[model samples]
Target: MTAAQFKSNRFDLAVDTISRADLEEVIAWLRKYPRLTMGEESKRFEQAWSKWLGVKYSVMCNSGASANLLMYAALESAGRAGKRKVVVPATGWVTDIAPAIQFGWQPIMCESDPVTFGLNMDSLAKILKRDHPENVVLVHVLGVPVNMTRLLALQKQYGFNIIEDCCASHGSRHQGRLVGTFGLISVFSFYYGHHMSTVEGGMLCTNDEHIYHHLLMLRSHGWLKDLPAADARRIMKKYRVDPFHAPFTFTIPGFNLRPTEISARTGSIQLRKLDATIRRRVANHLIYQKRLNGAVDFARGIPGDVISSISFCAVAKSAAQRRKIIETLDKKRIDTRIFTAGNLGRHPFWADRFGVFSAPVADKLYRGGFFLPNNQSLQGTDIEYICGVVRKALE
Candidate 1:
């Protein structure tokens, strides 16, 4: 049901979780499919996502984290098997950096633009000129697509690979192109509270033939039997066959990261509703922009880029005030989340292990930022009520 149909008392945050429909799909798939989890549903999910994102190929893994690993593994599988350095923006989900660390690739950290909250172009240039990593993990922070036109131009000059991190971005576009398409390999998260979900899933997309096949092998046991690709013969020759075929073939070093059939079906159902979901989120965002003129402070720095409204993000003037806002909203049954990872590098996870440090732009975002209850099902009145609560909170 639409939020407008509910009673005014229901103004508080609707449950921050996936829909019943998603649950039902997963259940139904389990009942119908003999193998509760396998490769078929994953295969279908990949095809659907490719069509949705306008990419030629996709690889589905058990989780978004695994997808990132496969994206890098595919590169390593293609014989770039050295300490490949990857330049990445400092701000993003923790898992965004997981693959680089796991695969022995060095991560050259860059900063984010306070404005777009994507890559800070100036900092990126400095790193590109100095460190010159073989890759860049361009994160589309909070669904704001990076300045791809300029970044791609630089890519040509520098000749490094791009891995678009779409963990928080689903329907985002940059210069009329989908955010995930710019990178040599794009990665997405289907985690709960994202644009879509399969409980927990992720996808890797690309048009490259070798990378595509390598990813297929990398997701499973890195074996020929597990991955039934059209280019299996080519892989056999490339990996030197060990003279074994079909029934038993371990062509390359691989991992058993296959996703479940149930999860895949759930994701497929969710995928069907993606465009509509995106529209609802876009509409709700417009409502906030129009009505919440003076209710609360904004990040005020985004580069006027069209964001997918991954979250209804804002920056309250004071932490105490933000706390009060959350308290009030919670009393009203409303839910809220802190802004993106809250200065991610400051956490011990990065500092102790990677020797990473924080930056000025990220530190500020940490102290004042938060994301409100937002999703495709949210309606105009729901938005109005949310903004109303924010106005009340500010007062």
Candidate 2:
């Protein structure tokens, strides 16, 4: 008898696949810390993460949003919190802006070129006409660099700090530098569907000692009371105040955004396999671009930029065609979505905000924007099936 052909239904593909080693790591953590103490697991995870990013420090938290929040909060506590505006990608997730608001900083959202799926430096240039903010949050959407070179040049000219949001861009590299290392304080997400998974976690990194210490304190409660005396002195000198005394002295106003022991343990195991995962994902993108070339247009990196494809987003001939194509793909149980929230300018909370520019390009793409599954777990057959399904939908 002939063997039945392998097939996976929508139900089978509903969740992302977590490797056995990943699962084993979590189980082992639970065995070691039944109640999940925040200790060695967390410390080891931070160390592993710093080594992975090639940065001086890596701070762990419960989620990427938390990571963003902690980074901004650290900046705030270190004294750039108010009267400073932050330039952010006008095309990313909502949490990307939350940190700015939570820290009392004005968020100047910049439009992105939907074609390139990266930040539009022209918009940034226009806004920086007067004076640049001390903190410029440069979020790399869908694993693509946001004109980092130009942005960095502008930052150097105006003296603004760069904060790279690599939540969807864990392994992405730009000019031989990892995404996280490019910014003063960068963030990474290990959400289940990301390039790697620690179930749900985030990391914050920086080469700056002051930012690193502040991030550590803000990850927990506002109390720097438990920090080393010399660390407290360093912070005090930066802030020009005696905020803390000896033990139990409240240093900087902070919050407890700590990661659990399991998350840390899971992250460490996953880090070991990150390079392999990224290679597979990158290979899949090349094959995807090759197979779907004529049928689809793609985003090219800047003249000297290298991109990491977070999602396979594309422009459709028309909005209706896009919807129909999405429906057709849905019928085949192939999950897909828009590049990033359609466009940030259209959102009610942001649209009515003061000082926000009309994101014409990003808005146009939002109407026609769509994405397809680019998960590393997808096999050769899965890619072929996806391409086949897309062709049918287009037809």
* TM-scores of the candidates in the order shown: 0.89, 0.89
* Alpha-carbon local distance difference test for all models: 0.75, 0.73
lDDT of each residue in 1-395, candidate 2, tens digit only: 00111334541222343687668767765776465756777888888888878998888898998888887788777775546688777777788787776656788887886445667877778778765667677777777767777877887777777888899887877777778888888998888878777788898988888788788777777666435568777756766665544344457677878888877777878888788778766665666666777876556556555555667666676688789888998887777777678677677767666544466767666778778767666655566667778888877
Best by lDDT: 1
Instruction: Tell how far residue 23 is off in model 1, in angstroms.
Output: 4.7
How much is 110 displaced in model 2, in angstroms?
A: 0.7
Prediction-by-prediction clash tally:
4, 2
**Best TM-score goes to which candidate?**
2
Candidate 1 residue pairs in backbone clash: 13-334, 37-261, 115-301, 115-302
Q: List the residue pairs that clash in candidate 2.
A: 220-255, 222-254
